[model samples]
Target: MKIRCSTFLNCHLLLFRLYFLSLLVFTFATTPEEDPSVIVSRFQKYLQINTAQPHPNYYEAADFILSQANSLSLHSQTLEFVEGKPTLLLKWPGSNPNLPSILLNSHTDVVPSEPHKWAHPPFDAHLDPNGDIYARGSQDMKCVGMQYLEAIRRLKASGFQPIRTVYLSFVPDEEIGGHDGAEKFADSDIFNKMNVGIVVDEGLASPNENYRVFYAERCPWWLVIKATGAPGHGAKLYDNTAMENLLKSIESVRRFRAAQFDLVKAGLKAEGEVTSVNMVFLKAGTPSPTGFVMNLQPSEAEAGFDIRVPPTADQESLEKRIAEEWAPASRNMTFTFKQKVSVHDKFGKPILTAADSSNPWWTLLEGAVKKANGKLGKPEIFPASTDARYFRKRGLPAIGFSPMANTPILLHDHNEFLNQAEYLKGIDMYESIIKAYASYVEHTRDGASREEL
Candidate 1:
């Protein structure tokens, strides 16, 4: 009887031990740390990190990206061309490192959002029942950054080896301007050493089933025109008053702006193909305790214009018009022209990437998209500037692409969101794209074959 009781107790103890051990294993496996392996979870984690300007939390973003790089076993480095702003670079070395590398670039910084305007908190990264992930940067670009990582993760898991090196660059300050980020990095020694063949960057979402790609982008030219003339009482009408001269210039700009807009409205030109100019600011007043001294006209009036010029446009002709008509010296107006970016490469060639069969990279990209069960729209010029312009200025071929089809273009807009299904599909698309780009080897080049195992 004693032995029977002892044996029963032992059995119970053993079973309890085994059950507890199993519970422990399950708990650890299902922990939050393990959740990142799930793509949507990982994306939400990235979106939760507030990297919005002004005042981006670059350090935290860098750490998160570095953790991902470590998980993938890729070599990662954080470079700061400017203090307080970091550029994260991750390299997945190919079997044949001698071949030119492929660069995947994404900006980490996003434009600031008003939380009150969003259905969910902009930083919350909420997923509605409709499967839309709502957050700032959901469409503007953070989606592309994570898609690049998830695609690489899938490729690595499949034990795929590349014939050419692959690099991912997460840069900052693109929302304001890339001066502290991509612009500096593109001109850095590290980029020069990479021997990059082609670059892939962010593109706009399409409202249709076909994904859009950009071969070139418009250059931004910020213009400030000031008019100086005799000051007088607001009620007194005088010839060549500060406001009068400024109004003439503004009228001239309005006419030119209308002509450019008419082309788009008439379907004669796409928005990207025309020169777009809009007045961003106007200043001419005498300050008072209330708001302004409405009784008096100021001696000087100023207006700032944001202008986007296509590479195909003649820049000299535009500048000449600005001097002779828009802010002519004869009209008592002076102007300051700030070309935010150059439209030409160092060799004076237009900063453009060929989208046709003439460019093997484009062919590879097109076929890869098709293989992924995706359709690409006709290549067009990006209506605004992007970091691709920096790469293109270096005479490197760069493509602006984002695989978001059947989605509204809500970048930098209120209630920006990306559908979970669409985001997942983008990962698959990028997987095909990365695989195709990394495996391609030019037969004409010496030693272009894959390295021996």
Candidate 2:
């Protein structure tokens, strides 16, 4: 797989661990002692740890989370399939262990940040009197990760024990995709043993007051197209040169890209409804020792794209499109994949979960939202990719929800932040969601489909 440098959700890992680890000691100074039980304080404290990837502070975060689990008397364990990349699981056992469990999942890693671009240091978790807590993961997700624990904290304090065991999973490296994190775990015996009935993972923040819940997401497809030709002097005009071939391929891809964007621009399709492609990066041409352009032409060139295809699209058709139009073999251009999401589960059925009556879990989730006195926007496929797809790949049903209302989508952007009132409100929101989903008294009927479970 090509290592593409990314911003946050879109980041390809670049800059080795040393660059990030060097910032650790400076970023790790503890936040002043505050009432750990206080929701904001806990959020701030959790945000203080620099769990930004390519080298996240997973151990420290796990230690803190395990301690919190202990305080609530919830059973907890840390699993490390790839040593150093920890998956922290906290369980509030249900009244009946025989039933399937509910999972509340959040990633512990955030994208790297350039400190100069932020009003507050990315790792500072700075909270002003205005209620905006400026930090890297504050909005992208450390907020939701801590909210899961705080919600459980309140539930425990209120003497509430859910009937179905509820688990909060703090996974690593989600920013780069959950391959080493949720992906490995979801396919493991430990995950299978849990018998996950439903899953709720991070979603986008809403600029509008109505909260958004994602039933599906546009699938991720990362591709690198390479072209080769004879090297020659820049002054020599050669037909079928490497750069020329690459530009042709890129233009074809860009034209297709423009067509998709045009659909959204014309209001004929939502951004999530069509395949979106951005030229992530390009490489070609020789570097000059001290000038702007090199005097020699390079023999090869490559271009990478971050492509997202909506769930309803045909995977085979897309592959054909790439083969025939984008990087045609006829042009001496060949493409390799970093990721191309499979369209179906092992059963060969389409990989979409209904948030409507088609799935029983939908009913339960909607009821929980209504009971919480929160308005849920119409269910839609998430425009971007997320870790939820990992669980979905295992024939599991997962919902992507962030519970961040009236907030701009600042995730992965400079000065990413969330409001204090909004943060606390999310705790309340999760408390209700957890109570409703976990406290179900009725048992799922035998042989129920993954959606029904």
Candidate 3:
């Protein structure tokens, strides 16, 4: 039956209302609910799998990470460089394609640990009385990995897709310089595809109340020096022998080391000093193979050093200094200097983040930490290093961060464990940071920058 004009207008409004209700239902059906706890629990479960270096059961971890990505309806891929080490990449679509993307990186592989030495089995995700989860990878990385996943999961669940794409990378071998992991990933075209405006990687722990944020990392330069001289009888003078030359070289290096030590001791060097030179290995003459040839001069001697230099220092300066001061002409000791081929090939250029770099991203982080009842501590660069360096080297504005507040950190050492309060606080810290950053993208980019991203 034909309706009157007044009634027709009312009917039209009813139809519109029905359509809006249907749309809401469709949206809710497609979007998952955001559960921060769910994310953390997922991470805890992930930690149960062993992912140690050399043979981290990477296949198992990769499958798990990929499965979660698939469940989230996100695109995931496993990049393989080494035979057994697999890197997993997961991407979430953004509403706007024009905005710059953000890359969240984490390494799944950890260093070998002796479970017998730990209070709990390193692989077992054992929770203590205070709710602190104890595990080998807990402090070093597994925690951070969960933070990344949880953040993205919440964003997706809330139907709050980012304006810029967010790429999650769980790579392998970062503990050992990322040979088949982050390093190779950086060189690949996959990274080039990411119009990454800002990156967030792992950071070191600060034992003191202050938080340590890393802007740059010292590049590692591993050097091996060998000396060869005359081998003679036990009663010989042994002048100009391999032992003498090696000792001289060692003394020269030690002198430089002493200066650095003094600087550190005197408070002249901050946490992230300009350089740190450590002698890791030294072997000269046969100890037992020759069976007590005390008086004879050995023909071969070797010394190895792990040298770290500030980003400002170039290869030329390092080499020149080693030649002049480390093995000077006056020493009259001929030596062979050998560096790891991989070290020289890729990391020859120091990876650095200038103090004055124009990264407004830092401001966002500062706000997040503050909101979580944490003040922005001194922005100290990392003395050691992290996967952040790889992203920084690729010219992405990367920040290495950890959110455990006012807690003792014992990463890579004996009796390492995060306090129960600190672990829970980290969840809050990550939630705040992710919300802030995600909202920032939404407001800045309005679905127009897909090509740029």
Rate residue 39 of model 3 by lDDT.
Answer: 51
Q: What TM-score does model 2 achieve against the real structure?
A: 0.88
Candidate 3: regions farther than 4 A off: 1-40, 287-292, 329-350, 354-357, 441-453
* lDDT by residue for model 2 (1-453), tens: 233433542442345555687678546643333353366877888889998878888899898888888888888889998999999988888988877889999988999998998999988888888989999999888888888887877777666768888988989988988889998988889998897888999888899988888888888889999998899887899988888989998999899999999999999987788999999999987776675366688888999999988878888998998898888887788899998887676667666677787777778778877787778887888888888888887777889888899999999999999999888778778888888888775657375765656
Instruction: Give all TM-scores, in the order shown.
Output: 0.89, 0.88, 0.83
Query: Model 1 lDDT vs. the true structure?
Result: 0.90
Query: Which wins on TM-score, candidate 2 or candidate 3?
Result: 2
- Per-residue lDDT tens digits for candidate 3, residues 1-453, read 346877999999999999999999998767654454555567678888898766788888888888888877888888887777788888886665566777788889877888888888877777777666677777788777777766566556666656667788998988887868888898889787766767778876667765667767666677777777778876778677777887888888888878877888898776466567788887876576747567667888778888776565456776787877766655554445443222122334345443332445677788888897776566665777677776766555577887666656767765456654565566667667766765565334344322212
For each candidate, the alpha-carbon lDDT, in order, equals 0.90, 0.84, 0.71
Provide the lowest-lDDT 10-residue window in model 2.
1-10
Residue 78 of model 3, lDDT score: 81
Clashes (N, CA, C under 3 Å) per candidate: 0, 4, 7
RMSD per prediction, one decimal?
9.5, 17.4, 5.4
Regarding lDDT, does 1 or 2 come out ahead?
1
